[model samples]
Each structure stands twice: as structure tokens, then as C-alpha cells.
Target: MDNVEVPDYFICPISLQIMKDPVTAATGITYDRESIEHWLLMRHNTICPVTKQPLPRDSGLTPNHNLLRLIQSWRRSTGNSPGAAAQMDKRKTQETSLNQSHIDKLIRGIGNPDSQLKSLQKLEALAIENEPRRKQLVEFGVHNAALHFIMQCHRGKNTNASGLPEALHVLYLIRNSSNGLKLSQMEDVIGEIIEAFSWVLGCDGETLNKTHAIFAMKMVVRKAKSAQLRMLKPEFFQKLVDYVKQRGNKQGINAALQVMLDSSPWGRNRIMLVEAGAPFELIELELKSPEKKTTELILGILFHLCSCADGRAQFLSHAAGVAMVSRRILKVSPAADDRAMLILSLISKFSGTNGVLLEMLRVGAAAKLCLVIQSNRESHLKDKAREILRTHSNAWKASPECLNLPTLTSDDVC
Candidate 1:
């Protein structure tokens, strides 16, 4: 069967295998019945894989009997029968279950120091192979085991442990299967997980290990409760800030930024981030013109941090901070614009010292606010921008940056 030159059209695009029961989707692309059904029903993907057009779950799939007959005839010509193919499929399923059993054995051995690294390597390989196996691993509670292993490594100061990276990678691959409610219920476990992430971030381990650590941490933090978030140590925020400063990997930097953003809703975490010099690092990162999503995450964290006096001061202390926020207005994304506006609003309302207001004018922030008022951004954002301009009109109204904009008038200000 492996030596047979099967027709290309007889292959399922989703599974990249020979189609046994070909079915034609509404988009006119034929796929194996099992593969297309799993894609549309199980995976819930609404788009046709081949045509990139809408293929609604409820859409009808007509049986392609002609293609199926041709496929069966071709198989018969190759000395294979439909019964043989069924037997092969049964054998494959048995093999998959056997692999699962092997994975279960490895997961159980993850706690044994002697077999830990080898077990983690095998589990990581299985989790990387396909999504179904990853789901199976999650169902087997591999995430719990991974978290426990990470805590163990942190406790032993095993920064150089060969298993740490594999463990972290396995957790990251199966992160989407995390049960948020279950995690939120386990406050103590959440705390230890956060601590483990902090240890990994602070350790002088390989860059790949740190990257996976942050990625896994980002997932955990996203699912953590507010109570869990409030209990986070200052060192956690400091390590994350340091990770962001390192800028080791693009995805890692983005994950670190997301973790800070997710944890910044609490006032204590906000202060901790500011104390860790987050504002300085964020401004520097933004100045480098990061990707749009990274910029949005950075601004989102800045907006939250700037809600405090120290955070605002820390933000203003960076020469490029205010200017960078202003530059991002109406430039990056609507999310970025929203956060940039909120950050500016915090500065103008809470930390509006004379020097800061003048600097706002100097960096064309006031003009950006005027532009926001006139831009086609959301009404709420425009209103916030107008209010900022109006509140600081006395300082900005006379400046050429503000005066040159026809939208800025005495009536626009109190």
C-alpha cells in the first residue's frame, strides 16, 4: 500500500491521507467523511479548508459516491480490499491507544528523578505530534503533573535540569485545555505555580526554557482568580519585567507582557510592576515598534500601572514614555489606541504637574488628543480624548500643535 501511487485528488486535505468515504462540501471540495466531519463538527472550524470560504457546521455535505467508488476500485487493483482497509484503521486506532498507554506511564514517571527527564521528553514529543493526543494528555491530567514537576524543580533550585524545558513545553502545548474553574478553586496550587514560574523566569537557564516558562505562566495567569493574583509576590513582577527587558524571544516577550497585563488589574500588582521599572521597559519596547499585538499588550499594562501615582511618575520619568504613547494613537490598533488614551488620561488627570503638562504639549500628545477627537474611532474613545484635551486646554490651547488643529477650539475646552 505504501508503494502504490495513489491519485492526489483521492487524498483528504485535512488528514493528508487516502479518502475512504469522500464527501463534497458546499464549497465543492471533497474530503473524507470522517476528516471533514471532525473538522466541521468536532473542531468547529467554519471555513472550508481548501477554498477558505464559509462552511457552516450545519451545512450539508453530499456523498461523493463516484470518488469513493474510484478510490475503492484503485485499492482493489492494488490487491487491497475494503475489509483490509477497515482492519488497517482498526490497527491504527489500537496503536494510538497503545501510545496513550505509554504516555500515561511516562506521565506517572514524571515525578521520579531518575526517569523524569526521559519521561518528559517522550510526553513532550507525544503532545507535539497532534491535537487529539494533546487533548488526551490533558484528560489524563498531564498539566497537573507538569505543574507539580515545575514546583519540584523550583524547590530544588534545579535551574539547569534537563527536564525543565520539556516539562514547560508540554504544559504550553496543552495550555488551551486548562480548566480555569478547577484552577481557580485550588488557591494553594495556583500560588505554587506562580512561584515556580517566577523561579524559572529569574533563573539563568536556556532561553528556550525561559520562553516556555513564560508561555505556560501566561496561560495560568489568564485563568487565575483575583484572589490568586493579589497574592503574587513583588519578585514575580520583577522577574517578568526582567524577562521583558531581555527580549530573548518575540513570543516570550509577548507572553511576559501579557502576564503583566493580566496581573496588573490588582493595585498591588500594579505597584509591584512599577517598582520593577516596568514603565521604563515598556516604553523602550514600544519605541522599538513591536508587533501590533505586543504594542497593545504593553499599552494595556501601562494603562493599568499608570492608575497609581508612582506608576504615573515612573511612566513620566522615561523621556520616551509620553511621546511613545502619543505616537501610538490612531496608529497601531484600536486596542492600543484605547490603552494609550487611558494612560494619557491617567497622567493628565492624576499626575498633571506643570512640567508634565508642558511635556505633553512638547511631545504633541495634546495634538494627538485633538486628532482622536476628529478621527473615526469609537465614540467613547473620542469622548475621552476630548475630555483630556478640554481638561488641559489651558496648557495646550495656546500651543501651535493644538492651535493648528481646526477641531480644537475654545468651545471644546472649559
Candidate 2:
């Protein structure tokens, strides 16, 4: 690791030599700001600035305290540096310039009546000796960078060229973008990636596919406030919520429940649990969350609602609403002692009015619970499930209402 003995295969692509710059490559990857991610994806201290090679991303140069000062200097030179957002209006004429490649594409685009990608290719090739144009191209392209990465994961004969890690880089960008900031009004791109999950992982795609999609979606949801992803447009949030609530495999719920409590803002906290159905009042309460009993309280609220005619109505109407409550009762809190109690509460709530309990009971939910309890490894659960079965069965003993539910079984339970 000494200055003289640089790592092998770690050459900078830009310079085609030892790396140098804010950070240099220490591994085989040579992508830099020009070719690397706009977010300074690499940060190793020394290497051929040109080659952009590196040992590995994990071991790359760590940011030093002076990183702020370096950032300031970069801003000064760029004029339109990020913090200079306020001053952009003053330099409208002199504002951010377009790269030569983009300009070239625009000019050549007039006559090139052939393929659209060929036009883009001509544009991509404008990298040579066109510094200003390159900068513009980079900035403009940043808007859709996440999209291109996602498209790389789609089904096709050419998919092998679209590596999984490369696909993950798109996800990494989505998850780690500053303040969880995401592009604005961009549903088509995000939708394509999510909808194709089953294709990406093949037949086994359902579990892993939902896991990754939920992870990124939650991160974006957590960071949003007063702003939905610009790219997702105004209604896109609802669409994303529906994606998980209905299309998601069972695993999506597990991932949604795993976000750390403290890091979550109240709005996100509420939305995280209730999906998009989180009301403004609920979100406010979630701000003071983590009071030791918050989870229980939320569960209590959920129980009172789950079996009610209105609650079921809400669930049936809103996909997110269904996911929010079901995740707590079934996926996340299943093993908790109170889970069965919550289900019982719901069952009782619907006892006189609606039809959930009757439907479930008719479907042999009583027998199903008994079987689950009997087979459960935890004796406590066995007892709890058995008690619930008994309670449900006996509830009808006193001239009980008949269940109109169609028959369901253990297979459907799974």
C-alpha cells in the first residue's frame, strides 16, 4: 500500500495510468466522475487518477474531515455547484452549460432519421476533447441514470450483459441518494423495474424480487416529506403503495417492518406501518413513537379495526390499507402473544355487523387455528392458538350466528 508499490490492475481509465484526483482507483474499476457515478462513487486516497482502478469498493479511501473544504473548492470552480442553487437565476444565460456530446447529438439529430439509440450513441461518443459538453452530458444524464440502470435488469437475450451488481448499483443510488432525494415524476422507469421482478430472479424471483423492491421503496418513502419523488409524479406514490400491498409477495411486509425506528421521521413512520393509508393524525402520533409501548398501541388500534365492517371496507378499497394492517397481524407480529388477541379482537368486532369472522369461520378458520397451534413448536403458541380456536368455536355456542364463509384450508393459509 506504499506510494511506490501501487495495487495491481488498479489503473485509472481516464488517464490510463496510476490514479490521481480527489480519490484514485485502488482496484480494477477505472470509472471516474467522467464515467463513474455523479455522486463520487469512489473515494480512495491514491491511485492512477487516469485509470481509476481499485482493490475493492469496501476498502477504498475513506473521506477525511477536510472533505468539506474540498467540496467548497469544487463549488467555486463549477459556479453552479449544488449549494449555489439560489444564485442560479442570476446566471440564467451563463448557467450550467450543455456538454459537447449533447450539443452534438442535438445538431446531428436533425438529419439522423435512423435509430434513436444511434443518435444517443453518437452523443455518447462526444466524450473526446469536449470538456464542457461532457460536463453538460453528465448532468443531464444524471436525471435518468437510475432508469438506465434499472432497464439493465430487464428480461432479454442481452440480459447477461446486464449484471445483477450493476442492477444493485441503481438500487444503491435510489436508497442512498442524499436526504433520500430521488428524481421527480418518474413512474414509468420505477414501475418497469418493479413489475419485472418476477422476470429478473426467474421462478425464484418472487421472494428476492419483493425484498429488493420493498427495501428501496421504503427508503424513498421514509425520506419523502412535502415531496414525493419528483420522477414519481404526484400520484406515483399511490401506485407504489399498491405495488407492495397487492403484487408483493409475503416478504415485502417483513422488509417494511424492519426500518429502524429512531431514524424514521413521523410521517415516514406512520406511512411505513400503514403504507400510503397513514392518515395525517396517525403520522403525527408516530413522531413520538418508540415510547416502549408504541408498537403495542398501534397493534391495539389495528385490532379494533381489522375485523370491523368499516376496516374491512377500507382494506378492500385501498390496497395499501390492506397491507398495513395485514403485515402487523400476520407477517410481522405473528409470533407475538398479542397477535392472536388482535385477530380475536377483529373477529369479535365483526361479530354482529360485517362478515369477516363468519367468512373465516365458515372457511374453517377455527380448525385451521387449532391445527396451527397443535403443530407449533412453541408451547405458548400452541396454547394460544388452541384457546383462540376454542373461543371462536364457543362464541357461537350461545345461539351464535352461522358463518357464511366458503371453505378454505391449510394450503390457502400458507
- Using Cα atoms with residue i matched to residue i, what is each candidate's TM-score against the true structure? 0.76, 0.32
Clashes of each: 0, 38
Expressed as tens digits, the lDDT of each residue in 151-186 for candidate 1 is 888888978776888788888778775352135335
Question: Residue by residue across 140-241, what tens digits does model 2's lDDT show?
Answer: 443244335435545442434323333333343334433443446554344454334323333233344445545655554454443333223323333333
Task: Kindly report which residue stretches of model 2 are placed more than 4 angstroms away from their true locations once superposed.
Answer: 1-240, 243-309, 314-341, 349-357, 376-380, 395-414
Q: CA lDDT of each candidate?
A: 0.80, 0.39
Residue 186 lDDT in model 2? 56
Q: How close is candidate 1 to the true structure, as a TM-score?
A: 0.76
**Count of clashing pairs, candidate 1:** 0
Given candidate 1, what's the lDDT at residue 20? 79
Q: Which 10 successive residues of model 1 have the least lDDT summed?
A: 177-186
